[model samples]
Target: MIAALVSAGAAVPVAPPGLHWSACASGLPQECATVSVPIDYAEPRGDRLDLAISRIRTAKPELRRGVLVIIPGGPGGSGLNRPSTYVKKLPQSVLDRYDLVSFDPRGVGASSPVSCELAPADVTQTAILPWPGPGGDISPTVAWSRRAAAACAKNGGPVYDSINTRNEARDLDAIRRALGERQISYWGVSYGTYVGAVHATMFPGSTDRVVLDSNDDPDPALVERGWAASYAIGVEDRFPDFAAWAAEHEEQYHLGTDVRGAYLRLADRLDRAPLPWPGANPPVLDGNTLRSNVLNGLYSDARFPQLASLMSAALAGGPLPPTTAAPEAALQNTFAVLNATICHDVSWPRDLRAYARDVAADRKAHPLTAGMPRNVYTCAFSPGPAEPPVRVTPDGPPNVLLVQNLRDPATPYRKALNLKRALGDRARMVTVDAGGHGSYLDNGNACGDAEVTRFLTDGTRRDITCRG
Candidate 1:
């Protein structure tokens, strides 16, 4: 089956400019394109935005099942470039059965961007997201949140306000309609899982086989809040992996011979006196910056080395790793969109007192994450408010399959379980014994991957469990 796909001239079409296609990465001939989607679905005839989309067509077009859309994580991450990156990881039989498709959500990647136009200082990792103090003092965080919110309000425009998961789901339906497909199959990872869920709920009849990996907590009452709180459990789950890695490299990264001791010492030192980060906007490695780096590093196991290197350098009284400034255009646009979607999805309390109370409680519960999870930010800074929130009930077909890692640092398994339960009889779940943000073709176990592939290719799913 794999050999046939290689010879199917799948690589004939050149991916659109800014989009690259490579058979080496996807393990098959791949092509890319840009699909223009409406920024606002309510006004399908309104201003348009280009979504960078990619595809790996089935070897036997006649036997092709249908388009299998791969949704990327981050609410801010791009799937537009995923077909080439993920195709190689899928089973050959799956690749031979359907055309794989992915796209950059609006305001991300090469898609139409919406920026906050924040000051360079505001864009710094520490300043962008407020992480409270070790002792739980949130005064600094409160001030930072206000400033960040103000900057976004002053700069972000309509485009930023327009980006949200509902609209993105609507955009996916539009893509299906454009492709002339009455129904489409889907595979979404991390935040993408949420996208798939929303799509399934909104257009139940328009979906075929569906897979949601590393799912999110779909509490309509607290969308982003739930995601943020999960970080505490997620980090606790994934820390073992990092600990083992650090322990194995004790000679090289001598923060401590034991992982726990090493992590504690590093945290203590950063809290006491941060290193000067030359050329960084703030020119310093504050506690919040350290926290951000830790959170970002935990996204994948492959990044453990980077964390070790940073810890070793900091402990040795050396310069921290070089800080790369986020592209002003990308950060502003991405942040604006992320905030718009999160804030618009639900009504966050305007009471600063309530936020302070939550921050205090969170600080006590999860010291490593500080009180950052509960810190408040204003989403009203965007031009338009979120459209009326649609309650996502599982009215879809029973064709959805959910795959999840037991310990994902970004979207934890517990949260994924919540989503699975919400789907009721509309879906079945495969819990992979793994640790990371994405499953299928990435951090998933063979059993889980095989199950999803079989379901996608032959429409068969397994009722099983996996253990690490």
Candidate 2:
């Protein structure tokens, strides 16, 4: 079941030999290795690329099930270091039964690296997206997209050009083979959910106990570009959650007593004259910066206080906050892989005017986001995708459980439903009334987590919805 003929050319991919695990000195009791895979799956016998892998074998091997991979989010996310953080979170039964494993996907983290070597100006986080000018002008963004594409073309070399999600699915198969598992389970979140879905579509027999959390829409025609636009409505749906949180503690933050008014006022002020935010990537704290930070911060409830404090400091006129998220190397890797997957997945509307119309409309409808979601980006100008998107369908292996939050701003609940409907009878969904991006030991309620854990631990399937 290498390639069941979806869209990544007529060629199916193949995996290299299984792993020879080596000792690693990390916080978690784990071993790391590299699995060789074809850089171009179309030519399985062609040049090879190494994908970094990590594992924490169950302490109680007598009770072992099979390997369960944790596919992280961000087409560029690395789960190699996640087990240490999540060691205490998993139930004893899960810990005893499965080896928690993860890896840095190709062109990400410790895997073979690729880069556009983007200049500082273009590399700025906000600049990475197509940001319209004060009067809704997109000329600058269009120019940047062209320039960025040229840089990627010159510096990304071959591997960067080849980094598409379809190949990532092939890479997942390679990882499975490397682990010597005839069939493996998955705990995939966000973009990883999309990878898991496609892997199932491509290799149905290789899957077991698949849990896709915070799903991506498997709409073959739209793909991630549709996801890019969906964020507008998502922010609209998700803003109230943050607003209410801020309003409840307005006296403490003192931005304003009226939550909506306070947030809007602050944003408006910043747009008029961005505060001098040093050490930050873009360096100036503008409305979109606040909005971008807010959008990211809204992913989990536990980080709500951090957003509040950042806003409080900004409103009170303090020095710039720290600028530390992903290191520059990882950021470079993420930026490259994210664009490679998105732009390569499907063709976006090529006309610039189409973007202008959408952005203007989105701004009016969702001012907190200020049309960012609907705006164009690097993908709009890439040399097009390497392969046509592998169409996703409900035809696949069973025991697939989808746990989604009702209000995920990044991977919105509505988008997840699209995936649920796409999977059809192949999957049963558990919807949580929570308001965050992830589920199953991340942001979901106990009822939802138990549904996933129980299914993984004992193959129990009770398709149910959980209230907040």
Candidate 3:
């Protein structure tokens, strides 16, 4: 039966030959290799690109089960070094049973990276993410979106157009073939979860135990647009966690007992009179900047102090926190891939008035986000997708497990429900009673970790909520 399943309609590519293992340049214990894949899967014999891959073989060959791929977050995230980083965190049972593998998706990291050649100003995190100006005005965001769209289209070429989630899945399949594995298991986080879901849907027969952690909404109509807007819901869901922490440390932060009110008041005050932050990307700390920082800080409990410190400094009108800017080349690569993938994967609404209306409503409904979630993106100005978004459905096998934090700031629990509903009985979800992004091995949630570990090692399946 397993043989029949493996032979039936599975897209095991023959083009990518077996990988030649060599010590990674990172000086880690893992081995690295490159897989040659077509830029356009439809034209397999056409222009090709190289994908960087890394893996750590299980020391206990006797306990070996199969290969487990680590799919990283950020449409532009690089997983080439994940095998090395995660080796210490993953349970010994998992390490002994599976060879941990990862890769830099095409257009990311060492895999023929693409750049939009955007200006340093445009490459800033605030610029790339489409945050609105003061008073929920999206005119600046609109202008930036149009300029960025043109720049990327002019510079990205065919390679940019080819970088979508579907192709990424095809790349994963190619990796599976190169490893000579009939079935590959994976642990996908954030945007990687969407990639994993699409892969499972597109090539169910080739997948083994699938673990989608910190999932995204798999809404076909609003693929990445939905993800962009999810921040509004996610932030609201996770802010109370931050608020409670701030309330506990009120004497240090001095934001008063009403921490939430203090946050809102300070954000509005900064909006009216921005603080000049020298050496910063935009060189100013405003309402949106405060909100963005809070959103980022809510990703983990350890980051609460950082967010609190920034708030305390900002509220006191004292010296502002120093900004740590990323390298220009890295930012260019990330923003380019982010734009290329999101824009090419699905179509976004091009109407400016529509965005204005949504932003206005969203700003009123969720002031903490300041309408950024409903604002315009480069996709609004870019060309339509070559193909429709892949629909994640329950047509696949029931070997998938989804582990989620109840209050994930980036991928909210409410939206993750959409993905869970889409998967139907094909998946069993483990919702952690936590207030951060990642679950399973992360957040120190022993219950969630044990569940995921057992599933990966012995194919155990159970749907239970874990208290963090």
The TM-scores, one per candidate, come to 0.87, 0.93, 0.96
What lDDT tens digits, residue by residue, belong to model 3 across residues 1-468? 322465432224344447898999989889999999999999999999999999998999877877899997899999999999999999899999899999999999999999989866677767877778888889999888888889998999778889999999999988898888778899999999999999998888889889999999999999899998999999899989888888899888877788778888999999898888777667788887787788889999999998899889998885887877778898898998999989989999988999999999999998878888899998888998898999998886788999999999999998998998999988999989998888877799899999999999888887899985
Candidate 2: tens digits of C-alpha lDDT, residues 1-468: 232422321112234445788775464577888989998888889988888888888999878877789887888788888765567798988888888888888888778888888876677677655556654567777888888878888899778878888988899888888777767788889999999999988887777788999899888888888788778777777777877888888778775656666676787788787888777777788876777788877888887888888788888877656665445665677788887778888888888899999889887887777787778787777888767787777776555899988888888887888888877777899888888888888774889988888888887776698986
lDDT of 3 at 157: 79
The order of the candidates by lDDT, greatest first, is 3, 2, 1
The top-ranked prediction according to lDDT is 3
Candidate that beats the other on TM-score, 2 or 3, i.e. the better one: 3
Backbone collisions counted per model: 6, 0, 0
lDDT of 1 by residue, 1-468 (tens): 212222212122222234344443334456666677776777889988877667877777766767788887776776766777767777777777778888778887667766767666666556556576666676766665666677767766656667777888888887776555667888887778888888888878777788888889887777776887778788878878788878888888885657756665667677788888776556777666767777788777788889888878877777787866666666666666677677766666677777789888876677667777777665423233456555667665677888888878878887777887788777888888877777777764677778887888777765567665
Q: Could you tell me which residue pairs clash in candidate 2? A: none
Give each model's whole-structure lDDT.
Answer: 0.73, 0.79, 0.88
Best by TM-score: 3
Q: What TM value does model 3 have?
A: 0.96
- Please give the distance, in angstroms, between residue 23's alpha carbon in candidate 2 and its true position after superposition: 2.2
